[model samples]
Target: MDGDDRAGGLTRRRRWPWVVLVLAVVVAVVVAVLFLANDREPEAAPQPADPEVVTLPVPTPTIDPIDVEPGTRFFESLPRTVLEYALTESTADQAAVASGAVEAYRLVLGDGGTTEVVVLASQWRDADAAGAAFDELLAAEAAAAGIPVDQVGTPTGSADDAAAGEQTQDPAAPTEEPTEPAAPTEPTLEQGPVEVDGTQVGRYLLVTRPDGSGTVHWTNGTALLRLDGPATAVRDVYAAFPL
Candidate 1:
């Protein structure tokens, strides 16, 4: 009986070591799986892409004001700055009296005196005198250009006449319904009857000189004006001029 008991004890002890080894292997597998799961980073939540950026444009200012004291009423009424040009000088010229003008004024305007514009304004006794003077000036300019006076510009109806429409009907004819007047066409550079704000103000003449500079002449009421500057700059100044 003793020998049988000793053999059973040895078998039970060997079975215990096998069971312990199996438990150890199971624990090692569980720890390895836990470590691997902790090491793996979670997928970053899908980030929304940055919104696209857009840009817009800026507008330019038309008028630029400056500080200056205009000596005469005519000069005082004039704008200090016409677009980019500034009025830099104003003077009453007695020499202009020789030309039959009651009052003659000269204005010097420029972009820092780099691009210059010289304005000569003269007031006359009456509309007839002004008209005659304008004709003489036109003739002089035409002769300087070596062209006929008519070629300079053909006289067109005033802005008032144009806006009202010309009406001519025979006295014997029956009256009909009046129709809407057609829109007045805008005049271009070197064109007759210069207009401002859709109204014919005066006749325009551009005279190119031997040099790059040029002269622009126009009449307003009892006053005649002449502007001299670089050809391109003079055009801009004339367009920007209020009177």
Candidate 2:
């Protein structure tokens, strides 16, 4: 072979090896980039959270008082004075039928015509009838006061039964010694029975109105009575009332 041809062949062999090395390096770089891309994790999209729920309490309903016109019959049974208040006006034969009573009377007593006290008296057929009527009246009063009926009064026993000592004890049942009533755990809306000389004379419910006035309803014998006046004065008037 000629010298020139041999030199050219050597140069070509060296150039071929360099080209193969460059191709190998490029292939390795491409494989590394693909592997890294496959190993990476994708980011997740954000989602909305559930809305919170809230509950509210219901409110008690209010009641309005009923009005009646003055009647003609004389209310002779009503007391002339209750504490410092004096009877100024009276009416009868107005609420008898509605109250399920044989007779009904209403009396207004006040200081100098200011109208501080009002008295309502009704007579039923018997103690049972009066008690039923009293329950109805108390329920109405409780509704007007926005309180539960159970919170109105706690009658130990009927006035007639307690007065007569007629409550019979069950001989077969175990006799438990009288225990003092537990102190009330919660606030009471009204008082319980009215006692005189350790005898339960009646049950009274004292409910205050929105105008700051008060009402007292009680039952004695066959009579159901109600007294309305100042929040502080009604209790005194009710205690002084004879009915």
Candidate 3:
């Protein structure tokens, strides 16, 4: 089922900022923005890339027990940066994205004792759909947090993740500090933890109207995930999910 069509009762198409392919330039832009945001200090070179691939199942999105961890039942823990970078690396191959179908995961992690993380891992129906949604999600997130964002032309192809590389980490990777985005803008932001159903969410963002809820939400094939929490816990959430 399409992620947008899952809501049976009241479903309506909401116009979101059009997302182009997740290309090299786009990734660079995102990286530049993160740097400008002072999200991190000059750190030692990125751990020697242990280019590896970790595949997860494609499942529908839904709330699970709070005690139980989020994401698919397959992989135990995957980090945000690794997944993001892998997706970036996979796009370098044009022929790959053109005639390829990968079973991957879409994850949204943040720091928090009770924040909700949405890990939408699945096989995308096509490259176009994957790239479009991936870019759109990035734009929406930037706008919500008032992070300056500009759309760029799609170069070659831009879809994240692939079966190309094995997912492995340099055991020497830094685990001490969590790289945090600059304080996000809050047209509607709440502090402290809140309860949803029977679970307590540390924090969450209600982006400008038409901006609905959920910290991060996207779909690939039959899989969808919406992980959200407070702004304060964003860093923690990202750190919690180590690929």
Error of 2 at 186 (Å): 16
TM-score-sorted candidate list, best first: 1, 2, 3
Candidates in order, TM-scores: namely: 0.54, 0.51, 0.25
Show the colliding residue pairs in model 1.
none
Model 3 lDDT per residue over 149-168, tens place? 44221222333433222245
**lDDT by residue for model 2 (1-243), tens:** 699999999999989999999999999999999999998886677777888787754321132223345442324555666656766666774766575887887777766645467788887788788778877777777676556787455544678887565457556778679999876433235768767779986677777665557888778777788887787778767766766
Over 4 Å off, model 1: 1-72, 153-191, 196-199
| lDDT measured at residue 86 in model 2 versus the true structure, 0 to 100 | 66
Off by over 4 Å in 3: 1-122, 126-128, 141-226
Overall lDDT per candidate, in order of appearance: 0.72, 0.70, 0.40
Query: Which of the two, 1 or 3, has more lDDT?
Result: 1
**Candidate 1 lDDT, 1-243, residue by residue in tens:** 899999999999889989999999999999999999999999999999999887643222243445665455756666666667776777786766688888888878767636778888887777567778877877877776666676555444577786565355456788788999755332222536766678765676776654567788877776778899888878778877777
Going through the candidates in the order shown, the clash numbers are 0, 0, 28
Of 1 and 2, the candidate ranking higher by TM-score: 1
Query: In model 2, which residue pairs have backbone atoms overlapping below 3 Å?
Result: none
Top candidate when judged by lDDT against the true structure = 1
- In model 1, the worst 10-residue window by lDDT is 56-65
Evaluate model 1: give its lDDT: 0.72
In angstroms, how far off is 167's CA in candidate 2?
45
